[model samples]
Target: MKYSTVLSLTAVITGYVLADTPATCSTTGDNTPIKSGCCPRDPSKRLRRSAREIFARTDSPTCPTPKFYGDSCCTHEFAKPTLDKGTFNLQCGANGVADIVNDAVKVEIVGCDTADDLTKETCILQISSTPAGSITDTHLEISTSAWTSTKYPTKDPASWSYTSYCVKTTGVCQVPLNKIGDGASALCDKKLYIAYHTSTSDGTTSKTCTGDGTLIPGQPGSRWWEYLTLDFTCPKTCDGWCCCEKPVTPPPPPPSTQVCNIGTAFGYADGAKNLNGNPVGPAVCDTANRWGWYFATSETSLSGTLIVGAGGNDLTKGTTVGTWSATITGSDITFKYDLYDDNTNGHFDLSSVHVYASCTAPTTCAPGKFTFKDDTLTGSSDTSYTKTFSVSGGTCSTYYLIFHASVNQQIPSTGTCPTPAQ
Candidate 1:
């Protein structure tokens, strides 16, 4: 039989088969009704009762009745709703079936200030359902089209395409939304989560699904979709001396040395005697057992001179006396005088003695005098004596001459000696 004819016959049979009482069978050759089962006592009542049952079970019955021989008993349908396209069917069922299409997820941005460029802006989009509740195969075709004051929504998405999918199990399909400026002449709006589908048991028709998203104003080229708010401002730059640099420190100066010039000089008078008291020895005078001259002087001036001298009457030679002269130069001055006895007499004698002299200053004279050694000088036929003196520093000065002569006789040795006077 033809497909349409078979369907009509099956519908009629199914209607009668569901009745409470069974119908009797008609036999062609026997000329009598087969009474294997009870017949419908009232065809009109049975037909009315069957019609009521069909009508009552019409709304989403447990199993859909097959329209044709090979029609499926279980079936499913799907539809998608979007902001721009409204609602439409993605799939249709064989029987009269109706299912609700979940509302489209929405994304919007609010609380934005255009004047404060660095201020954070916030946006919220309501998701129809939790994304994690969806199965792994579920996916959403989410796309956003922005309209600047200079642009329109009718423009193709590829021109400013910012599209993604809600395949991830976490987070809202709704995008956090934000804009740079206020809606002066045109509003900045976006449409998100346009389409979505979930895998089903048949692997053909998708399950029920919905999504939402939001958009946030963020720094350019940043992962802004993840954040609910963002701050926008011009980048900072460094120039001139603002960069990282260290201050320079100067090195310490070298150390200095102290400078000074030093010099010294010394002078002495000789009072040494051998065999007899006489000036006979080195210019240096002995400090013991003899008559000698000692003098000392010092000055800090750069240049000077000094002088010293001694004279005395001789007892061996009456009316006879002599002197010696000593001079010094530069910043220092020194001199020495010696006395000797030419005669072999047992008397101590001194002759013309000029002790010291200074060329730098003739007016300034150093102290000069004759002194006997603290210890006694004793010799049977020989005796010795010496004297010494010195002058260290002095300014430029001249030296004057002075001298003294003396004689000491412990043993009387008479002799007529000529006196040397100066």
Candidate 2:
């Protein structure tokens, strides 16, 4: 609400004085008796008018001269007039308090029949005060949800079931005397009230319901329920800066689509089956590709260096063997890695490997940050094997390496065993 300043009257004095004993006036106009009875005349023309005479004259009546209470000449007793208390009716204005001004404030239906049912319908009232102004007080009231001729328990039985009230105040509003001043006015008080009603259909069924309450003054106990009244006086003047409006948040941005690049390799190794049906390779063969050849592995080093080995048999040694190595790379949107076998000193073979690269923009092979998949082998034979491969690349955090290898046998009767079987 806007405020305007204007000159207001301070006080009004209405009455007249009397002259009885030729009083002397001081520099400041204090009436002091110069000579008692010096100007006295007939008793009927007494110098000072009696109280009755002063009361009879409505125009320019003189004020009564100061008289001592116990003076022999003055024994009149004056009684003070009594004043009547006043009552005021306050009603909710149209457009609610919002029409008062723009300010940051929250209004909600604190008491509702069913909260869930009102989720879609918000009983929220909002107000905005200018940066130069603030709402400092709020008042509320709630009437009976449904009126009943029957009396219900109430603090004030005289007003029971007829009406209920609630109020709240803050800041300057709490002060007994404070007016809305020019420039910026502070919010002081708020009052609210809700009314209840009932409906009957065909005089058979009666339904009672309560409507939303309105804010007003003079309701009982309304001063207690005002939800919030904030302090808006900023320590620093926000001359150019206005309070930010409550934000209307939009739904979160849609989930991002993910793209991946992958690459993979596989390998295997092979060796002859012993008389016990157990596969056997050289002690150094363990250092080399074995019957299960996926990647390099040593008793000392878990991940051994990749190597290519020669294959042949030492017949006198009764060892059957052959060695091979395989590697593959390609691009695909999707790829996976599975290990088929890990062998030493034998032929190495790899299943088809898949590779993929993904980018929101275009593909770039930045070192150390590229994405890719590694290979793993699960099964193998004495001379053959298989493995699974996976792809990695394109926005991947790491690249994978995969492979498989196997070995073939050379019979000593054929004299095909190389010296020491290089």
Candidate 3:
């Protein structure tokens, strides 16, 4: 007898049998009921898939769907506000409100040359959240020692808001400190942390919880300012290399002077000392105590007066007393002497006068009767005698003269002495 048997192909693969249906087992053999499992169509082509696959997606989706990489992709783009990455401290400037990029924060500082109370100043604030809040506005104020916060819902004023209680602490509090906003007033000089949180209208909240960007006095020409609404401006500076420096002026050198003396020892005369136009000293045979003669000084040619016997008494015309004079020319020295008395006592008359010149001292060291053969002064018209000498500054020496007297003719009533030629 032949027996017919049936088995589920997915359950027992050894019971493999050929059928006309797919792996879903839709077909049955010879009037058999189809409610049970059936054989697959191609028993050798491939195994059939069942409805109970473990890793496949089913009627329900996964809790968190995979991030979309499909056409359902979205893009929300916004240019960031102009950010100042440098010091947040605003430099000194004309007083006014200063707004950071896009009104992110409004820092109003009572600015002026006369600012004293900082409490009256706008707290330096930088909020990276929704600039404006609707339906409610929350404020967190930090001061040097304490902090206060006030919350108001939509259409509610902060002053009349329901949240009236403010907690004060000696230190700063982090953002969302179980509060909408929290911060502390930091000393301008001291950098402090301030954080803010603003609830979004879309059931989202914004945070601006970090700012050591302390506000400070602006400096001229520094890059410490962004959009300044001040009446004043801080100076700006740029990187540059020094090109030139100022040159120093030097002082002038001192002047140089050369001097030449008059007279020798004993019968010595000092032309610099004997000059009468500027008489600060007396003249006599007084060389031991003071020089009595004057010296002639000239850078090129000699030109000055010198006297001998400056202490001698005066005499009548045509007679030599002792006081004598010499006027200097290029190379010549003219000498003249007067008498001791002309009061008719005719006490004395000069027989001759001597003038001397030397490149070195003494022309011959002799104290007795020095002579250089000076011209006689015998006249009633001009009693002053004039002469000339040639003396270079440092080269060539000087000499002195003495006068000798005896009886002489009466004064010439008419004829005057010849004017010496230079």
TM-score of every candidate: 0.18, 0.16, 0.19
What tens digits encode model 2's per-residue C-alpha lDDT throughout 100-194? Answer: 22322222222111223122222121221121222222322222222123522343323433222212112111111111121111211222222
Model 2 TM-score relative to the real fold: 0.16
Ranking by lDDT: 3, 1, 2
lDDT of 3 at 172: 18
**Which residues of candidate 3, in runs, are more than 4 Å off?**
1-323, 344-347, 363-371, 374-422
User: Which of 1 and 3 is the better model by TM-score?
Assistant: 3
Would you list the rank order by TM-score, best first?
3, 1, 2
Q: Alpha-carbon error at 98 in model 2, in Å?
A: 17
lDDT of 3 by residue, 1-422 (tens): 11111100011112222122212212322333222121222334223433221111111111211221111100111111111221222112222234222323332221111112212223222223223323233333332221222321122223322123222121111232112223112222232223222222324643222122333223234322212211111111111111111134568863332211112211223333332223443333323333223343332223322222234221121212335544545455555544334455322333333444534323232233233443353432233333444332323344333322222333333534332111
Candidate 1 per-residue lDDT, tens place, 44-108, comes to 53245321121112212121223111111111111111122222222112111243223322232
Q: Please give me the total number of clashing residue pairs in predicted model 1.
A: 82
Q: Local distance difference test, per candidate? A: 0.25, 0.24, 0.27
